[model samples]
Target: MTRIESKLQRLSQIEATLVDHPEGITRAELARRFNVHRSTILRNLADLTIPVYEEGDRIFIDRESYLINLRLNIHEIIFIHLAGRLMTSNIDRQNPHAASTLRKLSTAIQGLAPQISQFVKGSANTFDNGSKKQDPHYMQVLEVLTSGWARNQKIHLWYHSQETGPIKEYIFSPFFIEVGAFGQTIYVIGRLDPDGTYRTFKIDRVERIELLTEKYAIPEDFNPDDLLNNAWGIWFTNQEPVTIELHFSWRVAQRVKETLWHPTQRLILQEDGSIIWQGEIAEPREMVPWIRGWGADVEVLQPESLREEIKNETIRFMNLYGIFAGSKENEK
Candidate 1:
């Protein structure tokens, strides 16, 4: 490895060791463990961002003060492993921070959960291998936005909106960062300057970002969970929540009832062995694609507008597939 790469690796190891051993390890022991000189260990320790203190000949990091020092039980570790696996599988882009997090988690639980640690390590390796290249500006934009959020500072960024078909500039104060449950797309919810109107911006659409000196505070009434309480996904609308009722054919009733699809979901078993599913959400448009995925097995039972929309969409699909409406082929 190059000298810089070696140094960075050593620094990471030193931090991990300190975190793992709250009682601390001697500088001499650290040098021996890594096969480096004592001076090199000291220099590397100084480069660490975590707060570390020397107690006699030993150096220690206070677990309470360390943000990454997690004490998880075996079950919790498994949960984290599964979540990380799902995240890595869904996000097909190179994210150095995510890889680093997986590596650190692997190191933290290697002794207690060796099998899970191996899987986590393998996931990190996949990211490091760069199987897919991310947008060139993604990392930079994410870092700037994260910094701005942490410091309560405003940010100026150039954003490209697919819906509006233009590149617009906004001065924003970030309130929260959220990932869409369905698509795994990361978004920032915040307020725009001057008008102070709340908006959500997708991170990938950010072309450039700059941290501004101006600072702002999140509103007292601004609760992210409350904002998304009735949302189907990341979309929030001022329209009143609507009750959505869907009927599932008996063929898919068992599969439909296997999981809780939403917080407000209620399932009613029918005498015919089919299922009736109902839920309340602010925006019905966000659920259209999921509704379509069920094809003929599911039908929208309420909201005539939404039912008509689905009927129209199905007609379009039929036409696209060279099948005419009211065709005998569909009956067969």
Candidate 2:
């Protein structure tokens, strides 16, 4: 079943179990019933508004809250389920319990409709392929960031820096987490304490993080999207945004025009069915791989520096693949 379907189903199951066994369910029993670890069950319930309490050792979801239904129809529930699935699809890598959460929800609402259950089960099966295991340390860091953000607290981080050759310490006031539009990499954007200068840090690069009691107020004028006004991808430079122009042959014109390569991109259709793709970018190096992907069909038209860089890279590629340039041709 898809993650959302699984979550809904699991939630429905939990409600039914709680309702049936009104006295309470022990953590071990619940974990065994759900086929998840005790800790996973705890994490799954951490953010939920469900009233849970412990009597001696058994934990119980408040009967009062469980009896209060949302009165949602199957179609409405399915729409919400689909929305949750899309959200999970984007952040599944970062969120450890994303699948389990959806599973719980799916189980809770399974009997609402047989057709819905079948669809949810099918989707869950399709997306159930094994995913990459997350680093335990990374998960710890994520927890610290999440907690700090929720409480408006600051964080002290010991982050590994490859360029700097050592771990660096910084006091960061995390304003928000940013994920790639296509959901590639995740980032934490915040201001360095004391300096108050904004910076973006890769979540994976964080070696260790500690949540501090010191509170911080996010700048009222802060805007995350503006930070990427000139970025081609994730790497941002302080250099002035340069106008980049590319001419694509008619063969790839439609393909080029269809994609929004950058936020500042503009496409000009030529009479010959070719396309002139133009955009402003802060870092030209980031665009190298993309430009090279089109092979000989795309040509850099402006920003002499970028054009030269591409030309140099092409020559390097030709030299690397001597079959195309001829190894002995240089000697001749």
Candidate 3:
């Protein structure tokens, strides 16, 4: 390993050791454990960001200030394992920090939960193999955002908008980081500087980010859950909620009934085994792709505008495939 890489690894090890021994460990002991001099241990401790203190010759880290030390039961560990698996499967991008976190968790629980450790290790490997050629800047951008969020600081960033087809600069105060329900894509919700209008920016679209020293406070009324309460996905609006109704074919009725797709959703069963699903959503546009994913197994029954939009999209797809009304393909 390169010098910088080796130093970083050593620093991480020191932090982990400090967390494991919250009561305190002697500087001389840390130096002996890592086979380095006590001076080297002091330098590494200085580089650490966590709250570290010294009591005489022994070093200690504030467990309350450190977020890594967890006292989880077997069930909690299994739940975390499942969550790790889901994240590995859903996220298409490569995240080195995520892989490292899973690896560390796997190692930490290897003796207590051998089976789960293996699964978590497998998930970390998935990230490594899957992200060989992905975007290189994603991790760096995420790190800056995470730091800024944790410090309650503003960030100045250049954002590339797919819709606008241009790069724009914004000074933003990050209120929350959220993962979309449909794509599982990461987003940072915040207010634009000066104007202070709330906006959600996809992390992938962030071209450049610099954490600003200037800090900001989240509004007293700002609650991420409340902000996203009416959202179909990540797109919520100030307009009134639109009531959506969908009819599901009997073939997928049981599958549809297995989960509550939305908090406002209400389902009614028909005599023919078909199901009617209804919900109120702030932004219907985000649900379009999800609705289309069901193919012929579902139909949009209400909101004439949405129905028409879907109908038009279906017609376009039919035309693109050369499937005319009376064509053999359509008949099939």
Candidate 4:
């Protein structure tokens, strides 16, 4: 099996085993059960890539912590199983492993469906959380970042920024680490420049990484959190901080109050039923496309320069397909 195949299928089997045996299993038995070599089992647990472990000859699974850490519900577990299986079964699929895993996950509810459906009896409970440690390469990256703390020179990474095209390459130094979800978590906060600037890169979204042997000293006063704390998302560039005030109509007043748009956004309700949102941002231009998404539901109140920018954008959008103003055809 390929890496993707092994990753998901192994996790699915591990989950099923954890559900079956609460007390855990012997490393040798686990290897036999999976039909894989003992060395493979040893590598899986020792790798710490997917989250399995062993204590002495006996192995165990940390189910509670695993679920809590990843914030996965029962449905999600089932989904992962079904998906993994499908990927392995369907050779025609592009990412057959991914498809199989998803298929397994989709049918995971059925793993215990018989027990839940026409159950006139119950199975004795022997399931335990401490089974064995899983070794996944993705998890190893976290270990390297948190403890190893090794500055692996400069790395050329392929990253997706605008969310439109392919991941472009950039050379930067990774400094601080943020542990997030189960798989899609773990982001590196570092500076692209040697002068201690700030940048955040998601380890998962990173399509490629090549560490160079050339080492550059990280600035003495570098703080990635301080750099990212001021903005929202990972698009942090050194730009002039500007205040953006927006007026939201009462028609969608509940919308603004319901969701968080940015880290520094503050909402104040006015008597006219409209709400005023105030936020200090370093990149006003980045906010334009998003604010435009709200359309007439929002109106930029201050920073006339931004307003003009939006106006120009509005005109540009209107003319995209030769949209004529005040034309009956445009009314549609």
* lDDT per residue as tens, model 4, 96-151: 22333344433444455644322211110101112222324444444434332353
Query: Which of candidates 1 and 3 reaches a greater TM-score?
Result: 3
Candidate 4 weakest ten by summed lDDT: 120-129
Best by TM-score: 3
Top of the candidates by lDDT: 3
Q: Looking at model 3, how many pairs of residues clash?
A: 0
lDDT of each: 0.85, 0.74, 0.86, 0.61
Candidate 2 per-residue lDDT over residues 207-249, each given as its tens digit: 8889897888887877767777898766666678889999999
Q: With candidate 4 superimposed using the best TM-score fit, by how many Å does residue 280's alpha carbon deviate from the native?
A: 0.4
TM-scores for every predicted model? 0.77, 0.66, 0.79, 0.46
Each candidate: how many clashes? 0, 28, 0, 47
Number of residue pairs clashing in candidate 1, backbone atoms closer than 3 angstroms, sequence gap of 3 or more or interchain: 0
Model 2, residue 119: what's the lDDT? 61
Error of 2 at 160 (Å): 2.3
RMSD of each: 9.7, 11.7, 8.9, 14.2
lDDT over C-alpha atoms for residue 86 of model 2: 70
